[model samples]
Target: MSTTSLGASAPSRAGADGTGAATGPLRARRRWSGARLAPYLFVLPALALFAAFRLYPIGWSFVLSLYHTDGMAQTWAGLDNYQRLVDDPLFWKALGNTALILVVQVPVMLALALGLSVALNSALLRWKPVFRLGFFLPVVTGLVTYGLLMGALLNQDSGAVNWLLQLVGLPEVHWLGEPFWARISIVLALTWHYTGYNAVIYLARLQGIPAEHYEAAAVDGAGPWRRFWHVTLPGLRPALVLTVVLSTIGTLQLFDEPFIMTGGGPDNATTTIGVYLYQTGFRYFDFGYASAIGYALVLIIAVFGIVQVKFAKEED
Candidate 1:
């Protein structure tokens, strides 16, 4: 009887221990569920704001594009506004100007940025932080302020730029007054303002590159230029792709510089799509047509963005 009672007590104790172990984990899991939900709850407000402000505005713009409006009256116009866009010569001119800037300025800016970044990353360079800050300062400056400064500097007669040209025995060319020079000035201003921003991005990416890769290249007797071509260039592919796409989008949306400096012409030479869109919607009071132009710009950006992403993936 003693032996049987002892065996029975042992089984009872084991059963109690097993039940407690399982219950403890089950309670812990319940607590974890609440913890996991807390992150989602924290993000809910931000998601709601994005949906209301960004997503809703985009959807409403599309809807508004399908209707003719004069601010006081609205009527369903279907595809008429898009058709008008097709026939508008000014629209094409603006698009061409935007395309020209994108083609010419983006590559030049990115190239300069890459070169500056590489130079800054070199061990030979000193005062790196100061140089980086000085280069990036223009990006933080107000766009209108930059535009005003550019306009004053590039003025045809009494401008500092003309004074320098005359000092160097070069003829003083019309900077903002002539069509060709106006376009060139816009490109120069854009490059000055944004190159440092791209350079900073490249610098950040360059820092993440492993030291071992460069050491390995050196072991194989690769010189600076060779290593840069083979390793640094390949490593910077992702940054290059990002900067190119961003530059493309920015150039297409060119406005403030042209509007504030050239006022869209000596002969509409610098009139970008953004300036034209503003003139159409606000100046001409053609809200429906303006919405159509906005959508067209969106399409252009989407197409270019997709192409850039695909090109980058293929290179990878």
Candidate 2:
């Protein structure tokens, strides 16, 4: 009787909902099972599509890379295509040019974006809606249209930019004919296209920062510069990191600007990985080699993304 009494008084094991399991473990198990399965069930379709489209194609491409195919049974030529890429000077040059753009264009564009975002966020900026629309307009403009308009604008004879330079008594810049000038043109286009988008990103983030921090800084006698450096910058770090990583990837994969505007060069100065991939696969019919380049680019982007995330985490 004492044992029975003690057992009855013993603390009960609780189920997930904090109810006594002895009341209904079976029901609890059913509930837990459903909970466990729910997420997988919800994600099943996306997983299926990823497997079918992304995973399968990647696997097939790896297999294809090991062979020489004429759209039929491929003769195995292990590593030959990869070896060919090593000796391909044009490929290296294209990569170098891309690196150059990534180094130069990304920083300039992001800096402009950051400044523009700060300005737009300022209460001092009148006609906020109009200014926002103006900045964002270029971002949504069709790539083809931008390319055509820019091409026309950079035309040596009647281009608006050259005409303006001439009007200012400055030399008419040979915008497209020279390789350096062509590279600069692509950079200009990239900056024009993306700065607004980055600014918009930054603007959204800026709006989320608690106004109290700025108020506190002001209370502490922090000047506008000090408050901005302390409050605004820290708040904007995440957005800036995002902008950098995305811009890096975009610059690395850049194709349309160079392809449409410069046709990859006055002398291949504007060619990038994307254009290289196009030339390898479509123009040269070397899909396997192109796939290899694509995979390499994926790895590069992954590494950079990892580094950026790590740095951001550290900063946080």
Candidate 3:
């Protein structure tokens, strides 16, 4: 009887809920499974929130683009909204303005950023951390505050910039009040705002480039320009492509700087597709058209991205 008692197994475990169920190995496995799933359980709420907020809204916007809505009471309109975009004069104007900025501003900004990155990455540079910090500090500045400051500085009258020009005997140009100068103002603001950000990206890429390549280039009697053209440019190809595509998208959707700087004014001279879309939806309460505009911008960005990737691949 003692031997049999010794051989008898322990009683079933009560779960954490205190209801005795499976015993021994099975109970251990159930607990193990729950432990394995515990992390996912903890993460489930955040995933749910993301789906509810970001994913659901994105899906709904696409659906909403198919209907006409005055902020409410959406009615099925099929492709009519898209068709309307084709004929909208203001849409064309906004698109043209965006394209102009993309063409002019992207190259200039990227070129400046690339040069800055190279300078920063140079071993001969002194106080590298201080320079880097100063360049990057602008990125952390609040958008509205920066915009207001720039607007005040670039003001046609009684502004520091104009005052300096007058002091130097240069005629004061209407930076925000004229179409041509307004666009220039916008480009300057964008370049100032994002050059450091792009430079940081390029700097990371630059750091990853092997020193052996530069040494080899120098050993082959390559001068600074030749080395930069061959080794540096080639090493920076991926970064260049990334920044180009991103800058293109950003310029196409240009809004914040122009909005705060010019109010898309001097007669909508600085109005971008983003600003136009906002005006259409919020100001006019044409929700469907605005949704259509948003999707059109998305489509344009996708096309540009694909083209850029294809070009990069070809270069590869």
Candidate 4:
């Protein structure tokens, strides 16, 4: 009887140990799942903020574009606003002005920036830090301040630019008064403000280029221009593409300079798509039309972005 009782008690103890061994892995798996979730939990706040601010506003803007609102009553307008935009001569003029800037200003600014980056990166250049700071200063300055300064400097009569022109036996230019001059002034201001920023980008890319490539080119009897064309140009292609796309987008959304400097005036010669959108929305109180213009601008940006990407891929 005693031996039988001992055998039954040993079996019961073995069963209890087996049950604990099985539960141990289950608890560990639960802990591991919680640990794996920590990173996503940490990112939740930023995701929420982005959704609230950026994504929500974009969605609401699209919805608003489909409805006509007069700050009082609202009605569904569907594509009427878009049709109005097509017929609106001012919209076309604005688009033309923006295209002109994109074609003329972007290339000039980027070329100048590339040149400045090369100069700054050269070993022969002195006071490199000072040059960089001086060039970058304009980028850090407030847009409104820069606009006011530009306006004062380019004033028709007492402005410093005209004063210097007269001193040099040249006629005073109507920098802000005439249509052609107004457009030119806008381009000049944009170039001055953004050139340094683009140069910094190019400078960073320049620094990353391998010195061995240039040395090898020098050994092969390649002149400076040939080396640049073969080695440097290939290296800078990615940066060039990036800057071009950015400049295109910026040129399409040009508003601050034209608004502050010319008020889209001088016969609307400097009016851009962004300026037109603002005018339609606030000045004319055509919210739906403005939203439509905004979407059109977005569409233009998307199409250009896609084309740029495709071109880059082909080049690659």
Best by lDDT: 1
TM-score of each: 0.86, 0.83, 0.89, 0.92
Best model number under TM-score:
4
Model 2 Cα lDDT, one tens digit per residue, 1-316:
9998777666442233456445588788899999999999999999999999999999998877777766545678788777876898987898899999999999999889988999999988899999999999999999889988888898889999999999999999988889999999999988988899999999999999999999999999999999989999999998999999999888888989889888887788778889989987888777778877777778888998899889999989
lDDT of 4 by residue, 184-290 (tens): 99999999999999999999999999999999999999999998899888999999999999999989999999999999988999999999999988998888888
What do the candidate models score in CA lDDT, each in turn? 0.94, 0.88, 0.91, 0.93
Off by over 4 Å in 2: 1-49, 69-73
Clashes of 3: 0
Model 2 root mean square deviation, Cα atoms: 7.8
Once all C-alphas are superposed, what RMSD does model 1 give against the true structure? 6.0
Model 2 scores a C-alpha lDDT of 0.88
Residue 17, candidate 4: C-alpha displacement in angstroms = 5.3
Q: Which residue runs does candidate 3 get wrong by more than 4 Å?
A: 1-25, 28-32
lDDT tens string, model 1, 113-200? Answer: 9999999998999999999999999999999999999999999988899999999999998999999999999999999999999999
* Candidate 3 similarity to native, TM-score: 0.89
Q: Write the per-residue lDDT of candidate 3 for residues 28-140, one digit (tens) a residue.
A: 99999999999999999999999999999888888888999965688999999999999999899889888998899989999999999999999999999999999988899
The residue pairs in collision within model 3 are none
Cα lDDT for residue 189, candidate 2: 88
